[model samples]
Target: MAKKNSATKLFVLDTNVLMHDPSSIFRFEEHDIYLPMVTLEELDNNKKGVSEVARNARQTSRNLEEIIGTNEESLEKGRSLGIKGNTHVTGKLFLQTTALPHDLPMLAGSKADNQILGIVSYLKNIHPDRQVILVSKDINIRIKARALGIAAEDYFNDKVLEDTEMLYTGITELPEDFWEKHSKDMESWQENGRMFYRLTGPMCPNFSVNEFIFYEFDKPFHAIVRKISGKTATLEIIKDFINGKHNIWGINARNREQNFALNLLMDPDIDFVTLLGQAGTGKTLLTLAAGLAQTLDKKIYNEIIMTRVTVPVGEDIGFLPGTEEEKMTPWMGALEDNLDVLNKTDEEAGEWGRAATQDLIRSR
Candidate 1:
């Protein structure tokens, strides 16, 4: 054990933390990091596969090698993590060169986890004046560490927001008196058959471009911010995809959220769009409908390629026997189901016509 300053805390990183985010080592600015030998062993064991975890493990090994360099003496004394370009990382990285003994009880499973816990316990004993915390992604490991009175915390650098409620939903609801507050100097016009409004008020500065805003009061208003400059924002009336006449490839938006999503998806100016919702929220269905409309009807896109990560929920089904498309067929059951629904939207198209349309959609 080595003596440390009271201001600098020592963070003992678990194998899962490194596997989750390789750059986590550099993220703890001005705080020292200690890596147990068991953690290194686990990283080595996980570095063989082509999965993201394996790739991150390999990258962590590379980062360690870069930090450790060719100085064997520094390995025992701890290496300064303040590399030339990364001035923010002003702490040293300590690797377990020699094992520290602990009197903790033996755990039944996961020897690596137990060994890491033991190392944290030993470090806490030696560095009583300094804070020694265990950073792990596994909840069970955190619980075990806490049960033993060892300070434990989840690696939070990878989290985009501490509270998910603070996340941007890409939509905002206007107050009931929105018109009365902002309609004083509001300017209105039309461009390309789309209605546009320029408004300046206390709320104008808070509005972000492309963020949907709606009012469901006496007169429903749904629009998207097109431009924002100074204290003024230009809002364009979004297409009413919920109306049957404005359906996208035989699919109409079922609700206000879906209408906003379709407005973004169907827009030609927006190059990228992301949809986040629960399983039955029509994300896939709406996306497929918009893609089909653009690719097949509008002829703006040459093809629609649909693919998703083929992660099985349960036991592995073993190697699937087929070409690339055939292997992916099982994973695309949702896509197939959505296409069936889209194909049936045309009542005028007979069964044979629907089947032919489905074939065309699949081919593209």
Candidate 2:
């Protein structure tokens, strides 16, 4: 391939970039697509996996196969008609593939990433005029690309906010008046402050009885929202879990932290919650109370699995071991302490402690 002026650009795609987002190829409608022979090999290896990205990659490869076939010369001349002329399967639409330049760089000794950068270096040497832009989602790939004097960028198709960790906007504490006026329907609260910016339709949907809404203006309080509540509940409600007496000496779930707690607690998909806390953060009590209300009172799930990781202080408690149940006793003993407080606090709460505890473990 002959090197031309910097009038046109050649795009070198990293395998991860393609995998990260399959729409990558279609996104760059104005550039010639270049995938190193090694990248094709990598993609072939990735295709055997059962991931959605693999399937999408396989489909994209098949489409490209029909367009470019195996003709190196046709690709070289930019004569291979594809979904478009501006888009080439082998990067030669604009002085596409060049000969390997100097040997690959000596970074990270023998990483696959380094080998990929080596290929990029060779392509850049052959087509120095056309901008050899390496597109990859891997930070290391872009780092190596730039280190070797090749222009590199993240795959624009790369994503964020796909999982629970990302979309969690945490909790939002509205003033009492705003919350009372808080309608799940955005149209009802159009004049309200920026709280509606994060939400698309309604703030909290009707399907949130198991979920929560915390209120903390001058004081901190919580409400548990029942999504898809049954006939027993006369009120369309999300009750708060707050008892000033029950407050841990130093426990604070305020503002965004409060929001995150509710976000995780009220999350419909997450049936279990485990809060790890130090001395005073009402962790143990809040857990027991919320759990009992949901399992028995509110009737969300059939049982509440309340247990904790017990790192024994020092010497081992002498053996009284039998089955796994007996073996768990030493560890389970500490969790019982919290339940004792809960049971002692509410006299009418029934014989829930041991019964719920046993049923919870047995159900598991």
* Each model's lDDT: 0.88, 0.56
Q: List TM-scores for all candidates, in order.
A: 0.82, 0.45
Once fitted onto the true fold, the runs of candidate 2 whose alpha carbons sit more than 4 angstroms away are 1-11, 15-32, 42-73, 76-119, 122-131, 135-144, 153-240, 243-291, 303-364
Clashing pairs in 1: none
| Residue 175 displacement in candidate 2 (angstroms) | 9.5
lDDT of 2 by residue, 115-222 (tens): 668767777776766677888888877886787788898765455544654543323454565435443332312232212111222344432444344556766544
Name the candidate that leads on lDDT: 1
Q: Compared with the true structure, what per-residue lDDT tens digits does model 1 show for residues 130-191?
A: 99999999999899999999999998886777565787999999999999989988999998
Candidate 1 local lDDT, residue 140: 96
- Write down the worst ten-residue block by lDDT for model 2: 192-201
Q: Give candidate 1 misplaced runs (Cα > 4 Å).
A: 1-8, 37-58, 68-90, 96-115, 137-143, 156-164, 313-316, 322-325
Q: How far is candidate 2 from the true structure (C-alpha RMSD, Å)?
A: 10.4
Candidate 1 root-mean-square deviation in Å: 3.7
